[model samples]
Target chain A: MEQIGLSHIAITTGILLILTGLWGILTQKNIIKMIIGFSLFDTGIHIVMVGVGYVEGKTAPILDEAVQLKEAARQIVDPLPQAMVLTAIVIGIGITALMLAYALRLYQKNKTLDIQKFNDLKW
Target chain B: MIIKIIAIIIGLAILLMALIAVYNKKLIVAIVAAGVVSLFASVMYLLLSAPDVAMTEAAIGSGLSTIIFFYVVNKIRKNRKDHA
Candidate 1:
């Protein structure tokens, strides 16, 4: 039984990455680490979506009648995930870039990157 | 059964890496390990048949984020040695 195919591995890895990212966010004292955690979390979700598209031995979803369309479709991998991952990849980059800019600004304001050290604004 | 075992091993390794990222004292090490964790996750994505995700993971997770982190650390550390 090939029950444990690629999706199983991808989903498991994605979940693990999210959990690890959460753990990092909760335990780390640095803002940069927290950002890193966030990135990991984002990666986890993206992978999950992409993994959902995988069909064992399926060809890329494209218009092709040379190879019986119906049977080909039976084995064709979903195209939706590719589109979703494309969107997600761009979004992830945007968020990371923004977060890095924020980190830089925060460092400028506080002169340190330690989250614990920035308690002046907290009532 | 064999594929299941392989998946289990990969999952366990990811868990271990997560733990190390959370518990490691050095910030640099944690960031690097986090990148590795993402890189490994990308490979797992490939295993799961998501080449698109695998490509994204390789690019953003391991590539862009790591560079941004290195810059953030260097920028901050240059001024504050104690925090470094």
Candidate 2:
């Protein structure tokens, strides 16, 4: 019961982070604010993924003195999520850089940060 | 037990900072607050037993991203001043 409760705490926090990021993305009008929101959203998803992979009272997946190869399957937390998150974090940085470049270009063209002002694509 | 409580507090701080980053009228304040949010989230990742993620978040999310933002903002301001 205690183990489950503790794990739930992590998961709940991840969910809350996700909600906060979503709110930022939805409400903010500035392009830079929107980029910040996107980064938060990416971080939130990574947290949730890592939180879900955590097993109560388990060590990291590294095989060492504390955690042996024989008991690794049972004793180590899931490594797949951690691996995926590693890739995701790098990819998130790349995507954010791209978004910021776009924001810079937009600002250069329009001389404003307001998203509503970028109406060239709007029909 | 205590770690879990600390994690929760950090999570709440991240949320509050995210809100401030998004809703603040001043762009510079919002950008700085957003970087703080990423920094705290990296700490939360550590508490969640994701040291690699924490490092990456700190380096890329908090460090590089904020620097890039400030650089772009500076360029934009310079361009505006030149235009004016």
Candidate 3:
């Protein structure tokens, strides 16, 4: 059997987190719970993105006195995914905030947070 | 070597908290559990050699997002009490 590594552990956690989020999103009747599920989903995706960029024994992308400039590329893990995850984290929070605000507005409109009651598109 | 074990432990903790966030009966408890998941995930990112991502997840995911969720929850509660 292959020994588990950091990437393996991280990606596994990400996948499980995504599954948990999906379960919550599907089974919960409350809008707030659904929003929390979405947040979980976003976090899972971020974790997976960062995990995929890991090198076996490399350091982080940031350069410091410990890392030589000429050998930086060989010494550091992939930076593109890290940069992408940075943007994703910010966007995830923005999306979460927007979702919460929309849920509040929906509750205001009907005074109910139940998913089944807002079935305007049910035909 | 030992870092791998630590990573595994943290991963399990994150998964457990995520399950709690999904399956808990109390809304506030669920929200706090989700915040814990984010914090643990930031640690996972650090282990994966993504410090920048780790910092961002810590600050934005666990910090600001939890506050916003709590704010919205409080607002909803106030709305319910106002009507009741």
Residues forming the 10-long window of minimal summed lDDT in candidate 2 chain B: B44-53
**i-RMS, each model, one decimal:** 2.4, 1.5, 0.6
B1-84 per-residue lDDT for model 2 (tens digits): 777788768877887887788788887898899899889978877776677778888998889888888988888879979998
**Ranking of models by lDDT:** 3, 2, 1
> What DockQ results do all the predictions give, each relative to the true complex?
0.47, 0.67, 0.90
In model 1 chain A, the worst 10-residue window by lDDT is A58-67
What shift in Å separates residue A10 of candidate 2 from its native position after superposition? 2.4
Question: Where is model 2 more than 4 Å wrong at Cα?
Answer: A1-4
**lDDT for every model?**
0.75, 0.82, 0.91
Return the clash pairs for model 2, or none: none
Best by TM-score: 3
Question: Candidate 3, residues A41-102: lDDT per residue as tens digits?
Answer: 99999888888999888998778997899999899999999999899899888888998989
Indicate the TM-score of model 3. 0.97
Clash pairs of candidate 1?
Answer: A6-B48
TM-score of each: 0.82, 0.92, 0.97
Tell me, by DockQ, which candidate is best.
3
Prediction 2 TM-score vs. true? 0.92
Residue B63 lDDT (model 1): 89
